[model samples]
Target: MNETISNSPHQWNTQELPVVVIAGYGPSIGESTARQFGSKGYAIACLGRTQNKLLDSVQELKASKITAAAFVTDCGDTRSVKEAIQQVQSHLGRISVIVWNAASYVGSDLVTGNDDPSEILNQIVGVGCAGLLASIQEAYEDLKAMKGTILITGGGLSGYDQNVNQIAVNNSWMGLAFCKSSQRKLAGLLHARLKPDGVMVGTVIISGAVRVGGGLDVTDPDDVATAFWEIHHSRHKQEVHLGSLTQLASEPT
Candidate 1:
């Protein structure tokens, strides 16, 4: 595993690079996080549902010395996640890290007095839990061999704030809230169980909306990326909260 980077952050060159598989990647914090790792000589694999957005992100990262690729992935599906990880390993050498940043924005039919109990269960389990399990299973050997980490992006809606959860309940955002809460729990559980096996698990609770456009200007994407980098660098701690927000998705960035 040899890598070289010039004094310039953009001049990264590597032969055998560890792969950071970012699931649920998008144009905002996901892209920034990719660059943050790319600048550090890690090859990046951005897995998302949108092909065009992933390509755009790849272009942005390639502007530097980073080796990046776009994989159209449905992180909500176990098969898709497994296949994506396989593709990443085949392309980027090995799976060194996983960034779980995807979620379903579907209305909580269960909370809103409608019933899609089965679908909701599948979504929550598939995207945030079972899907992650599949991802880990696919790369577990490599990750354990490399002593890598699983970083989850979660925040206020993880049953942390009664007001936020209540607002989500009121607004039928219970689905996303459920995802956040489950992911928070997942991070803790994985942290405890995987630590002995050389894998680190951590979650960043972004209290503010990601600074992408007109909302949550307080949470800069690069800052969020830095927080992830720092957590990975420290290689300990189960979770960290970033930024400040009075409400969840209500205050308009």
Candidate 2:
């Protein structure tokens, strides 16, 4: 964790404060997630590619007088992720909650007759699983030291085949598998190696499109955010599957 604060309105000086680092802060889920945590009195570190959008979210959080910082980060890049984590550690002290919401879709396909699977797989794995690994690795020590929670955003695309045209259908399948596998591994590692130190690893699986007010079919970013918060604050500390999971498998006991 770095301790150098920049000349930004979002920067706040604090010691031993719990912070929430939102990766892939965007107009929809990212923004909503940041605000959700902000409303909960957690300092926010918004990491994404769009500087202006990140700044806007920071300003929105600041309007409520919440501590927030907009960090330009490319999750796919390890160096960028490391620097972003350092910035959060520096500005907010320590991150208590980490939300892995960064995602990329190359295309969707049935995997039966896909012309090029490499590109799509690379993108999905790069942003979904690999990027997640980088972020987790960078923050592992901090979270472990503070006994924090790592929550990854996911959809019910685990077993369904709705998007047969785009390669994401196949690639996301791999991504989900990788994510679940990684979660299991991280949980095991945390329990064996870091539990004594007090850190927990988990995932929040979102199954369907989030519904908003007026019966309008809006994505429930807030619901997802709430799920993340629940996972962080819950006593059980298990993998949470939100919305619907008729086809998804239950966690092994």
lDDT of 2 by residue, 98-182 (tens): 8888766444332555556676566656776676677777888878777787777665554344441122232444455444444
TM-score of model number 2: 0.76
Q: Return the top candidate by TM-score.
A: 1
Model 2 weakest lDDT span, ten residues long: 163-172
Task: For candidate 1, give the lDDT of residue 219.
Answer: 73
Task: Indicate which candidate wins on lDDT.
Answer: 1
Steric collisions counted per model: 2, 11
List lDDT for all candidates, in order.
Answer: 0.77, 0.65
Model 1: CA > 4 A from native:
1-14, 113-115, 213-217, 247-253
Residue pairs with backbone overlap in model 1: 215-253, 216-253
Compared with the true structure, the alpha-carbon lDDT of candidate 2 equals 0.65
lDDT of 1 by residue, 1-253 (tens): 1111112332222487888989888878788889899888888887887766777777778877678877888888888888888877866677888988888776564645565788777777678788788888999999899999898888777866677766676666777778888878877888889999989988888775677533542577787788788889998767777766555445442
For candidate 1, the lDDT comes to 0.77
